[model samples]
Target: MITFGFITIHPNQENTYITEIARHSDSNTIVYRFIPTAIDPATEKVHGEKFNHESGVWETAVFDIPMYLYDRCFYGDDPLSIRSQPIMNWLKNRPYSTFIGLGLPNKWEIYNVLRSDEELAAYTPKTIKASSVPKIINKLIKDKKLLLKPKNGSQGKGIIGLMVTKGKVEALTHKNQKLITKSFLSKSEFSKWLDQLLSSRDYMCQQLLPLQDVDNHPFDIRILLQKNENGEWIEQGRGIRRGLKDHLISNINAGAEVLKYDDWVNALPVQQQALLTDGITTIINKVPKLLEREFLNLFELGIDIGFGIDGGVWILDINSKPGRKVILHSKEGKADELYKAPLQYSAYLEKQSLVKGVD
Candidate 1:
């Protein structure tokens, strides 16, 4: 029996719902959640633990047994706000512990190691920052549209696409959600927007690659990867998302629809499919290795791939804390199974990696 603690947004993320199913599927393991609630007369265990309204942390009445742990608490007022530092210190003293979502001891350090546009571009057709946005825009005048994105962002957020028309430049979200319109009209205007956007967050100007369309909507692929019980990183599920008509980005969170990867790939030309697979594989293989060497610990990641009209496959983003809403809503439910593997694998790591009475 292994105790798995959850310090996350929702209690279900503690893997309680999946643990029973996993027990039946896995056979060799027993998993349980540390539920804080009213104590039963017979078991003397608390139930419905109260959320510390003032501190914004959920308090567990009993300090139970959980050899492994997962951090899924990023919702509401943020449970980590009050408990993080002490909880992390306590985890250090525990026999074994592991986390599922983002925010571990040295996460930023790990991100910096794998965060390279050029290294990333080697595998996928990605447009990194070329001198400056104005410079890049000046060159793309012929193409008319370009995309600017923060180097570090997720969920299709902070993506700005610029359209140049008759020497005028307009900015829009990746979904073609119009943000602001202006003429690169003047150097001062371009410089002002560039400075505002660049200073807001680290951004890279990318050449807006063309995308294959479904019903006139551009789409992209999101491959969620996780380490299996065997300790090998495997692509859990690959899903394609079609953006709204005329939108350049295809993130499901941004109103895109998810489809099976095979279904989408089969629809493309054979040569195109091969290029997509090879390009995606090239980046995926290198990214994990880089993360391990630089970030210290990262067991899973969500890799986003976008295809251009010219048939070039591009890397859009890498999400360390991936969203599972699409998978949960997938009809086949394979997405659900795939998503569950990480929690189980994290438990496996806790049992195998943490030696008794040692650091």
Candidate 2:
């Protein structure tokens, strides 16, 4: 019997997708416990939400530490908060309890690691931590355009695109519910804006690439990769996320629409399509192994790749606790594969635990 414990920020047992994972997990020996990050250590149990498979409704239930804990907690800016910190510490000390996707990694950390690796360096874009206006200006002068994103940002939040021309500096960012475009002709004004943004959060500067369709709608491929029952990395599926015309990043949450993957690739020239698939396959073969060595116990990853008009492919992002927007937007069969992945991977972990006792 393998008991899977899912930990998230909130207890929303009614979430159909959440239940779908548990529902598919129903079996004589398989059980599930949905836990929130706010844990009470004195009780040695957490305030968890468990699905009542028979009743078809989730009810309040106190749960002890299960065989494996899955970290699905979405900590926006601060991955480790006071509330979730204790839970993480406790899990670290628990000998019998194991965790999958233990913690979210920083973007800059990933870039630095990949930058140092010989094989991955060729695939990594030039990325660096933005500390001052001088550094930003230098990148703009060299690259002409720059993209600034928070190191810990997720779902395309806090992304800014800057284009430098002769006498003007135009900045673009998504705010509230719409895209905002601001122009700074004065050097003083632009520097002030840069200072404020840098102080607010840690940012990374990357040389912006031209990643848009012929109609100027920015788009990218979101690849959903997961570890299967055999504990091997597999490409579950892929989806195309197209942003509004002129929008910088192709984040599905940021007004991006899902397009059929096959349709998008088919529209491209036959030779370009071949290059696209070959580049993606190269990424899939290399990224997972490097990441597993850098971190540990990762069950899945959502890789965002950008393709330029010149038939160039670049890795845009790597997410440990990846969002399901890509898979959910995929075909019905792909959605089923996404839901089944968690349970399947947990069983694999359970088998590994039996072979080598959890430390």
Candidate 3:
């Protein structure tokens, strides 16, 4: 039998999603289980939990580290990734064991890699490590408006948008389903704010691109791509994320609304829509290939793209283990694909492993 281990960040819950994979899995041929990040390497086992579909509850059990694993763990925060490092090393080092989607990559690492690609570089905005407050001052001077992104942030948290000129700076973020605003009237004031803001974390600075829509709602396109049963990257779906009125961030979990992809596209002017679609289609076709080549062994990507007020399209962010917002709002029956993707890909991995005799 083929053993497929699925690892995630949190512990047992009514994990209906994981259960969906289990329900559809091939019986007698494949045995799969879910494990938490709090694993013990000494025993080479996890307090593996299985979803009891019949009971509709998570059932706990112990499991040995399998030869094949679907690593769905979204590693963030140095301490947790550090804690999981030994286990990661153990699984990756083994000649017989294979892991799909090895682990998440750092945003800084991704930026540096993607920027090296000429095609990709054209759409990516100028980004640099926010190493010092003075350097941030220089970037503000150059771009006039800037965005500060937490290097390891997820779900639109800790993202700060700043609009600057000679005098005042407006800093924006999404908080508690509301827009959080802070103001600084001078470079020294902004610099002082940065000193306190960035003291505890590493951040990347980027030029804030124009995204003012007809109604002035900050909006963007979120396209989620994933590998299929045949190991080909394909667009799962694309949806529009419209921010609350005048808000900076448009993350759905952070209180933004999901808009259907076609509806939003059709609403735009003919010229702008054509321009936006052309650039986005090209990006969707290329980014997955480039990232897989550069990083190697990835199953899915969540690409965030948006257009400037002037009809220029740009990539806003890239996520390895993307959220389900886009899929959730997609056409009828499309949401079914999201749960099936990991399982289908895992089956592919099993076939590949067997063909190579697990070495």
Candidate number achieving the greatest TM-score relative to the actual structure? 2
Residue-by-residue lDDT tens digits, candidate 2, 196-256: 9899999999988889998998998999888888998998878899998888877867888
Q: Which runs of model 3 end up more than 4 angstroms from their true locations?
A: 29-38, 52-57, 75-82
The lowest-lDDT stretch of 10 consecutive residues in candidate 1 is 30-39
lDDT of 1: 0.59
Q: Return the lDDT, model 3, position 344.
A: 81
Cα TM-score of candidate 2: 0.92
Models 1 onward score TM values of 0.70, 0.92, 0.90
Query: Of 2 and 3, which scores higher on TM-score?
Result: 2
In candidate 1, how many Å is residue 132 off? 6.4
The residue-by-residue lDDT of candidate 1 on 267-328, one tens digit each, is 88998888878888787788766666554466677777777767776666676666664555
User: Model 3, range 1-359, lDDT digits (tens) per residue?
Assistant: 65667766555332566676676666533434654455675775677765554565557777667656776665566576666656666677778677767655778988877789888788887788999998888888878889999998777888998887447888887778888888887777878888998898999999888786777788888888888988888888888888877777788876778888888788779998888878887888888888777776888888998788888888888988677756687556875678778878877877876789966
Instruction: Give the least accurate 10-residue stretch of model 2, judged by summed lDDT.
Output: 28-37
Could you give the candidate ranking by TM-score, starting with the highest? 2, 3, 1
Compared with the true structure, model 3 gives a TM-score of: 0.90
Q: Alpha-carbon error at 246 in model 3, in Å?
A: 1.4
Could you give the C-alpha RMSD of every candidate to the true structure, in order shown? Answer: 7.2, 2.5, 2.6
